[model samples]
Target: MGGRDVATASIWDAAHRRTTVGLLTLVTLVAFEAMAVGTAMPRAVAELDGVAWYAWTFSAFLVTSVVGMVVGGEVGDRRPPGPGVLAGVVVFAAGLVVAGLAQHMAVLVLGRAVQGLGAGVVIVLLYVVAGQAYDSRLRPSLFGAFAAGWVLPALLGPLAAGLLTTHVGWRAVFLGLVPLVAAGLVLLLTGAPGGTPPADAAPWRSRAGWALLAGAGIAALQYAAQRLDLAAAGIAVLGAAALAAGLRRLLPRGTVRARRGIPAVVASRGLLAGAFFGMDALLPFVLTEQHGWSAATAGLPLTAGAVGWVVAAQLQGRRPDVPRQRVLRLGALVLTVGVAATATVAVPALGGWPAYLTWGLAGVGMGLGMPSVGVLLLDQSPEAERGANSAALQISDATASAICVGLSGVLVAGAADAGGPLWPAVLAAVAVLTVPALLTARVAGRTVAPAADPSCATNLGR
Candidate 1:
């Protein structure tokens, strides 16, 4: 059957079933680990007496992951997806083992850095796998499935992690996932295409150097965000310059300026991720501290948001007739509105329940925009450049999210120090993020040259 025909048939049709299942399983495993570990981190830090290094736990992962993404993309472009993915799984599982057995917070942080590296490699390879194994027609569905994979994890990961941490110990949460990692590895390997070296190898060493510099810059910014002073501000300027310099070398040309086409797609990914995730990182805290909601009640908004995301993703997947740019613009507008509405939770009269709804709307916006960017990225990317471009997309997201979250932390801390309301500051941060999202909406609308491959359908005009 033709690729389009196969796509119209079903994602579960015999021809596509194995890859679909494998990719979904990989996403699920990753999603579950992310949610579970985040939930258990507080206890883990307390037990290790590393409260001072608490933020590093996350920062370590974020920084190292940038290196992994760049390396994995290079590897994926020059070699088969299987080896890179398998290696990532092995590294990730080893990190889990080390973390599970750690006696000190330092060791745990080290393990987390290793885990971040593995996650970075695995995610980039997965994107390459999708680009290679699936046709354009099926790509949207595949991306939608990837988003849906997060739903079960979002619903259950925290609960399961809590239970295991309470009864079996937090260590079990790390060790127990090792087996699932192995299972995911098997599926990925089976589904991945055989090794066929590229005609020309990607320049790895230079990219690696740039990635390292970028990682260091990001680390510096993370540290600076925690401190509020003129000296820190000066240091932050240096860090930002370093980050921009490294990004220029690592990402496609004009990415820093949000140039039309691929650059815009990459820019939008960063803006969307920063606004949504930064807001997300603060929501639970906002509810508990400002509105006196219980932890579980505060978490409800996140759950609602996840559901909204899945619904919108599925909707977008089912309706390929809609122009991808239109979907992106619509999603961005929805997200801006949702975020603006969510800010109202800061008001005394609005109460907290509105957050559950507004956040869900924001989730819907993310659901619509995120997958569209993926589809657009794949659509615009030539076969030879898919890995590198995919890496750029993910790297944009990781870097932007880290910076935005850091900024939000600074805002919240400054608000607390001033004995003022914290939500307004956080809301201001969220509001500021919407500008890029809105501005990039038009940039995302710009067209790109069609893929060089004739067999691949072009959605730019459609």
Candidate 2:
């Protein structure tokens, strides 16, 4: 299961057309749900008046999803991943239906929690499918395409969600998913038959322990967010204990510190994702509270970012033969520029378009770097532990983003509650984001080297 067992490759795999299609469909569903919720949640919360627990809805899903990822990774390594994926999709669709019919905030939260579980399973399962089905040569392109699949949601999520929420009611947002999820399920099941033999052995990842860790960690995080109380200390302690038990036994050594090639890629992704999305989670509040914009208007910059992501992804796909490390470095440099540009909005002489520009560039940066990072990990990740490695990747993102965004929320909430200047609060959020973006850029410059194919897996000895 160690990364040493995996081999690297170059070029694209032409034979996996059906498998690739299946993977793409899964990615599309993920994008759809993400964007759809971004649009509809505001209305859902307003109607339910569950603003008090706003962050929990997301936090709950994220925390459980992390565990699901870990568990899925282990399961994926040892058996047929298709059944797990099918179960996940069904649960997710059921959650959506329940959410659409929710009559109370509590019920809605419960549905969201179920949805979170399904999402986590599906997310890791997609990685498993990619790892198991695609040759090393073709993975980068696939990852790039995966990132591209999200573009539709980015382009239309907010606008569509707004319309649905405003006119059709947010309930329609959840209900609308029925057709898409159903279609994706059918496609995944029928699009590709068994392409590979099942694993000959069982993976060692413990399901019960992983569930405990994810549940405890996220529950603690959410509880901490609800009230900065002394009890947070106890909950945090419990979460830490659970996470350690689950992850310490599973992930590669030095993963938290990015010690070597694979760990470095995974660690860098976690930090990078945390910083970017943390900033993202805050930028909207700044627009709405400080600049006096509408929810729809606040979403425009994000939509622009989505556009940038799509463009970059498509370009990357077209040039699948490009050097990977170079591409990664360039992507990192773009991220630095994008993040730095956020501060431009603070400049008095500039108009609000500065912020929009920043997000757009950041999106492009993400499309280039995110897939590259994932592909690089896949390069080094041992085949048997595909789910484990993928879980590590997502947990890194979830853990980091959750903490960063949660911290920003606390800072912003505290400031607003104290009647502090809104711009200053926004700046505080922006400042934290800049740190990781710059650091990641430095890492990319120091670490990445040109490769024959940006999409394949390779391990340069650290």
C-alpha TM-scores of all predictions: 0.92, 0.84
- Point out the worst 10-residue segment of candidate 2 by lDDT: 5-14
Task: Identify the candidate with maximal TM-score.
Answer: 1
- Model 2 residue 6 lDDT score: 28
Per-model lDDT: 0.82, 0.72
lDDT of 2 at 65: 71
User: How high a TM-score does candidate 2 get?
Assistant: 0.84
Q: After superposition, how far is residue 246 of candidate 1 from its true place, in Å?
A: 1.5
Return the clash pairs for model 1, or none.
none
Residue-level lDDT of model 2, residues 156-257, one tens digit each, is 676778888899899988888878877776766665445443455443637646665756675676567656668866776776676667666546677766
> What tens digits encode model 1's per-residue C-alpha lDDT throughout 324-384?
7778888888888887788777776776779989999999998998988898889887666
Query: How many pairs collide in each candidate, listed in order?
Result: 0, 3
- Model 1 gets an lDDT of 0.82
